[model samples]
Target: MTKTERQKMQAGEWYCCLDSELSALRHQARVAVHQHNTAPPDPAEILSPPLAALFAGHGENCLIEAPFHCAYGLNISLGSSVYLNAGCTILDTAPVTIGDGTMLGPNVQIYCAQHHKDRALRAQGLEIAYPVTLGSDVWIGGGAIILPGVTIGDGAIVGAGAVVTRSVAAGQTVAGNPARPRNGWSGQ
Candidate 1:
């Protein structure tokens, strides 16, 4: 039996993004996102339920500022007290898990999907996805872009405007493009 595109995507295998079911899911997510983004700014009254309904799992204390964007909200989960600032975007072609007390700065982008390295394959809309995991107490600075398959450890800090292409060690502070660890005296 052949696996469906959604199955392949969820399993982190190569899949076609142009599949009908996936397209429909994206459309549904977009509609939900639009509602959340445009709704009046009343955290207790307007935002929480819709945002909670959009994600696969989220804590009660999770707070996300308006203008959030995601390809598939069902693949994203958030732990307790997770805070996402304005203009955060998550391309959740695969699972994206943000742990407790994690904070994402404004305009932060997390991507779990990538196109084929081969031009022809990419042209054919073949893509591969991998999960992104941010552990507890992680802080992602403004405009940081986290690439596919990156796992940021607990208490790690990603500097502003950095591009994280690799996993960060626990308590490490990484800065700059392609995010390298800072040479500091203490991990704290």
Candidate 2:
């Protein structure tokens, strides 16, 4: 008869972030992330057992450098050969899909949660989530911020320090804040 906060969140509907269930989930993610960030590196594993278990799915050779953080790790799915450099943060309130061969440079941030515009609603932690998808072979440069509901197509290049507010088409090269397609630029 009634949908849970988690269900609403996954459905891209407005939901309260301060819900007890969501709080508990975030706590669990924090613990795993702390361990992942602080633990000594082991050549044997790309991700620690506890940390790897948090993801919905992760493929072969997926590497996420230390100091990576996610609001809800279970909402992330990484394809084969996906590499995320250090200082990456993903606010995965909704599902985040990284396709095969995608590489994210240091300090890249992906945000899926959009808080309510109303001050009262924001104070209450009300937000809606939208999935962010990166198609195969995409390259996101350092310090780039991919906002909610953006889908980056295959082979696209996102230049450093770009704030991508819109979706990028396949094979496009975009740079600068509010990321627009770069004209006459060959992939050098």
Candidate 3:
């Protein structure tokens, strides 16, 4: 039996993004996202009913500000006390997990899909996806971009405007373009 495009994507194998199932899922996510973004602002509510139901897992007190976008909401999991600021975009072709107390600043982007290097494959919309995990108590500053397959460990701090291409160890502080470790700065 052949694997579905979604299955291949989740397995980190090249798959066509033009598959009908994937397209439908993306459409569903778009509707939910739009509802959440345009709904009447309720200070007490962050994730609207439709948007919350779209996610695979959502823990208590998770707050996602408006203008949040994801390719497929079902691929995202959020733990308790997680806060995502406005204008965050997640291309969640694969699983994206955010542990408890993780806070992401405004305009943060997380990408799970990597397009094929070959021009023909790229033109064909073939890509592979890898899971991205942010452990408990992680803090990602504004405008940070987390690439596919990156795991940020517990208590880690990612600096503003950083492009993280690699995993960050627990309790580590990373800064700069490629997100290298910084000696000090606990990010408190």
Candidate 4:
């Protein structure tokens, strides 16, 4: 089979190489970030290089640290002055885009793919993908779980530990399992 074609065989060789390539890249980036951050400097420049390697496209002044995970290399893009804290994991099976000046708190999980709910199909490891987007100046609080195809609008604030299942409007503050708008516009 070709690179994208996966047979029902026990071992998928194509998948292994792709995964390995991504893993190596991530590892290298992680190491570089760790090394670069050993000494602190002015806050104006970007703080992490590992984060840059993980994205498909990235602008200036981004600071991404902690642990991160993704599927394909070309499925992610990020804008300038973004800060992603520790333990941020991104499942980029599809596309994931983050706009400028967004702050992602610790332990934030953003997933752009979902597996089948059916146990048999899920066990078979067959699944589809969906893309996710976040607008400019949004703040995702600690431990938020953003699901597939969710578009967080500009200046939105996602509360800590909320499980977001849908799109959020501009300047909205949302919280809860299936996040809904909190009091009012508090996007700052």
Candidate 5:
């Protein structure tokens, strides 16, 4: 598992201090714009164009607002018809995958890596990567934070300002500080 993922991580981090990575990322987005079909295409403000291109393989309809931050964007896979509102932050030290038609409200955060609590490991300045996946049709409200390795299944809705530390299954609606299942969505 580590072998397959390590290369990508290395490839992505390689550009953290290199200009070539930025240039390459931008070039890819331009090519994608010409090669694929994108709606309301800006091609101008694709934030972190290099990083976006590296991670955005075939993921379309992504609305990434300015001032976004990430260690690596290559690990993210966003499906079509999705919107990421303002001030969205993705720690994406690992991989963050958002499914089709998913909606991310303002100030939403999806994280994929966390440092060890123990000082010994934390002192090393190393991180452990965890993958985050949002299933199709999921809706995450504003100011919410999805922690590492958490999965939100299809059609699940997370309330505003919730802190998700566990996984939520399909059709569940959850809220509160730690985000417990509030019961199934009240809709037909």
Candidate 6:
């Protein structure tokens, strides 16, 4: 039997994003996000119920500022004490796991979905998704962009405006586009 588009996407295989089931999921997520974003400045009223219900997993003490965005909220998980500042966007076509105590600065973007390099295939809406994982205590600076399949190790710091295309070692400090280790400081 052929797998559904969502199944293919979850398996990290190429799939059609225009599938009806996926569209419905996106719509549901948008509704939940709208409510969360527009809710009054009360954590108990917003995060505890509405925002928490949208995610696959949400740990205690997690705080996400308003204006957060995600394609499918169900594919994202947050650990305890995680804080996401304003303008954070997660394109969670695949699972996105953020470990405990992780902090994301304003305008941070994490994308799990990628289109085919072939323009023809991309034009047809063929896309692949890979999971993104951030280890405990990691800090992502403002405007950082983490691409598909990237794993940021524990306690690592991603400098502002970095474009992380590959995995970062634990405790490493990475900066610049296509992010590289800063000042020869290894994770040590």
lDDT of 6 by residue, 131-167 (tens): 9999999999999999999999999999988999999
Q: Write the per-residue lDDT of candidate 3 for residues 124-161, one digit (tens) a residue.
A: 99999999999999999999999999999999999999
Candidate 6 similarity to native, TM-score: 0.95
How large is the C-alpha RMSD of every model relative to the true structure?
2.0, 1.2, 1.1, 5.2, 6.7, 2.4
lDDT of 1 by residue, 8-75 (tens): 99888999999999999999889888888888887475236666888899876888888999998999
lDDT of 4 by residue, 52-127 (tens): 6556799887876645455444567889888888778877666789999999999999986566678776676556
On the 0 to 100 scale, the lDDT of residue 153 in model 5 is 98
TM-score attained by model 4? 0.75
Q: Model 2's lDDT to the true fold?
A: 0.93
lDDT of 2 by residue, 89-170 (tens): 9999999999999999999999999999999999998999999999999999999999999999999999999999999999
Ten consecutive residues with minimal summed lDDT in candidate 3? 179-188
The TM-score-based order of candidates, best leading, equals 3, 2, 1, 6, 4, 5
Candidate 5 C-alpha lDDT tens digits along 82-188: 77777777766666888888988889988876666777656654456678999999999889999988999999999988999999999899887899888655422
Candidate 4 Cα misplacement greater than 4 A, ranges: 1-47, 185-188
Pairs that collide, model 4: none
lDDT for 79 (candidate 6): 93
lDDT minimum window of 10 residues, candidate 6: 42-51
